[model samples]
Every structure is written in C-alpha cells, then in structure tokens.
Target: MSDGEELTLADEIVARARIHAREVIDESELAVDLGALEWDVSARARRRAGLCRWHADREVATIVLARRAYERYDWPDFAGIVRHELVHAWEFQQFGESGHGDRFRERAAALEAPRYCEAFARPRYVLRCLAADCDWRAKRHRASKPVKSPDQYRCGGCGGSYEVEHVASGRTWTTASGYGGAKSALGEEW
Candidate 1:
C-alpha cells in the first residue's frame, strides 16, 4: 500500500531483471517457472555480474545480480548480464544443473545473451610510464599480478619503468608497500 517507504536497492534490481527476462526469453519450453522465481542482488559480488542459485532439490531457484554491476555498466550491457544469468537458470530448468555447457550456449546464442558477463571492478590503481616521450598508463581495479610489483615490469610503449598511482587519494603508491598496508606517498619507506 506504500509508494516508496519500504523499497531497497535489491527491489529495483530484481524488478528490472524480471522485466528483461520476459523480454529476452520465451519460457514455454522451460520446466522452471520464470515468473515464480525469486530474485536478489549481491553486495559482495565483486568478480561477477550475475549468478543463478538453484536449491538442492532443483524445485526452487533464484537469480542474483551484482549490486555494483548496475553502477558500473550501461543499460544494454546490464541487460546482457541479466540474460547471461537467465541462461544458467534456463539450463538448470532443463537439466537440474547449470554451467557454461553446450545446451546453455545454444539458448544463449539464440536469445542474444552473452555466455559470460564482463567482470566488475572499480579502478583503484593506475600504472604510469616514465618514458621521456611516451604517455602510457593502465588502470587496474585490483592489485593483480602485474600491479604487485610494478617496478619489475616495463612499459610496452618505450620499455620504461612504472609508477603505481593510487587513484583514491591522488598519490603514488609504493609498490614495495604490498597490497594490505597503508600506501605511502612517493618517498616514504615501507
């Protein structure tokens, strides 16, 4: 009976994903009732955009979307992510299990849903080259392999060394400081 008093962000994500599911899929062949499925948004989903969780009995299933995905992607791309998760749902509906299997691929291709969702990460670090005439820089959302010890790598543009900059505070993060410790500005020792 209330207009906007009790809605959360998950409500919005669930509502929109349901709409996209209907628009992109024809559920007549599916044993799982798409209309009766539960939906939710995951706050801790950093590596993936979507997921389909099926109960052990396979009689119930839920499609979960990543909260950060909506913040990072545009509508069309977001819709594809919803579709990708739905393909998993569709597969589970038929076989009681789901993965990036062959049948899932066929349905995904027919429905124009991507087989995989683009990864979601917020750019927290930047690798900049100090080459005399080169202006090369790479944005890294996480401290992955290449960012672990940036000084150990050379810029492809001119074989120059790198300086890792922390995007949040506009300061250069010392590579030797490792990932967990508080990043020191340019010259502070680890």
Candidate 2:
C-alpha cells in the first residue's frame, strides 16, 4: 500500500458497534453481527452521520458512515454516532421494531444514545437582493424548491426583491448582476 493508502477503519468501527450492542443487549443474548461496515464518501451531506441496515433473511447487518461528516467529528462524536446506530440495531434485533417509536426511544434512553437519527444537508442555493449597494442573502436547502420568481421575495436588509445569485454545491456563492452577468468575490454574492 502507498503511504497515503487508507487503513481498515471499517473493521474497527464494526467491532466497536458490536461491542456497543452487546453492552446494551447483554453478553448472554446473541448480538446481531455487524457483518459490513463502510465509510461511504459518496453519500450526500444531507444524510445522517451513520445508518444501520438490518438484513432479516441473512441475520446480519451493515453500518454505513458518512465519510465527510465522520472525518470532521472527534472520537467522542464518532462514538456517539456509532452508538446511535447500534441502538437502532439492538432495537431491531430484540423487538423487531423500526423508526423512532416509543420502544426505540425508551431503549435509547436506557443506553443514553443520541435521539436524532438523521442530519440536515448543507444549503445548495443562495438568493440575494438585486438592489445596487445592498447586501442581503439567504441560503436554501436543495429540496426547498425556490420560487419561480424569486424576485418577488424582498430582502430583509435593504427591503429589495431577491434574485437568484448563486447555485452550486457546498457554501460557495456567486453574484448575479444584470449589467455584468455573474461575478463572485470570495465566492460570495456580496
């Protein structure tokens, strides 16, 4: 392997997840095997930090960690993410239940796990006022379905109607000018 080759992080994660499950469910009880663990870099930022997929027919489960968010979190945060997924796994195996129902909430509370299962994605669109020398903007989710005529919405700062200024992934934004078309300073419309 090259110097930059990634190590077996998935293996360690799987082992840790199993340990967490066993702790909650008890050692005498049969723990659900975390058969597969993968760091999915391709997963969208909107997705939760970790997801536990249970396979009833195969009697196994897989844990998928969002690589981008995982990379940013410290060990404690990462463990919390793992414990959150494990709670789901334990609940599924022991009770055959899904979703954040009463049972799931009760079990999670006993184990002191994170309540939320999903995370919100970063804003994908930006709306800015068209008024010259006025600086006002808004960040919107991809699913927000921006209005057909964004110009109808007034800016909070200058009380001017808003116009679509930037559209892209991440937090970067570009100015949309009627005279010059589009220009960006520090990747912001202002």
Candidate 3:
C-alpha cells in the first residue's frame, strides 16, 4: 500500500485500540482510568507485532503495530490486537509499570481470554506422561501444581505407588513436602 493508505490504516487501528483501552480501564476499575491519561497510540511498521507503552509526565501512551507486522503475520482482526495493547494501557494506569504483578495476572485471567486482546496467540505448554505407553496429553498456559515429587507415579488400572502433587502459589511440590500432606491422604491408592 502507498504511504497515505498505510497512514490511514494505522490511524484506524490506533483509534480502535484507544477505544478498547478505555474499556479495559473501566473494567479493571483501576485507580486511574485511561481517559485520565493524556496518551496517543499509533501504528508503526515494526519487526514484531505488539503494543508498547510510552510514559510522559505522569501520563502513559501506547503505540500499536502498523500494517507491516500484521500483514506479515496474517492477522485477521484489528480489534483483538488493539485490546491487547489496551491491557497494557490499563496496567500503566493502575500501577505504572509495576501493574503487571499478581493483580494484573488475576485480572487477565478473569478476562477469560484465549489470547491477549491484541490477538497474539497466547503461550501454550504441552504436558505429556513420561511413560512410553501413556499417551496422556494436556495443554495449559501454566503447569498444574504437582501433588507428588518427580519420583511419584500412579497406575490408573492397577494401584501403584504415586504421590499427590499440590500446586499452589505457582509452585508445585509433592504432598510429601513439609506443606502438610501426610494427614490429608484419605483415599490415596498409593
């Protein structure tokens, strides 16, 4: 596309991103809203397709991707891309760079989004049983807490020795850990 055409498309993308930023700010119920900040977002032909925040005088702004990245990546929708950037906008409004802490993780999770608002595919982790015959597979954003240590395993058909792995606070450990599990083994087959 010509320079003028690119500029127009970039403007449109920024406008939509700003709107979504407002929505995220409202939904977060953060101390400061996106409207309260004096920021502007525009698209640029960057190597990577993503959003970034620019802070100015206590206010934060964002710039999303332009046609280059999207065109290269075959992005289908603009709204989703904008929404992801808007999340960063909301983060800036809330905690000013530190907003990406546990609270942010919680809010993002609560959003029930398969991918970021920006439409970038979320990270995926594949879990497979170590056993050769076991074809059990699981996909998750984060790994589940381990109820048992790596030394533990259970047989579904025949009762085998297995320890439960408890995953909490983003840490995984076996029930045998000091976190209290001995008394909790009610019907444990192991």
| TM-score of each model, in listed order | 0.61, 0.52, 0.42
Model 2: which ten-residue window has the lowest total lDDT?
A: 170-179
Model 2: pairs clashing at backbone N, Cα or C within 3 Å: none
Candidate 1: regions farther than 4 A off: 1-6, 27-32, 122-190
Q: 91-183, model 1: which lDDT tens digit per residue?
A: 666668898878888878876788877678757788888777899988777777667777667886788887777777666643556443445
Q: Candidate 2 residues 127-171, lDDT tens each?
A: 777789998777665423332345444677888776654454222
Q: Which stretches of model 3 miss by more than 4 angstroms?
A: 1-7, 23-32, 36-47, 69-77, 98-101, 112-190
RMSD of each: 6.0, 8.1, 13.3
TM-score of 3: 0.42
Ranked by lDDT, the better of candidates 1 and 2 is: 1
Ranked by lDDT from best down, the candidates are: 1, 2, 3
Model 1 weakest 10-residue run by lDDT? 181-190
> How does model 1 fare in lDDT?
0.75
TM-score of 1: 0.61
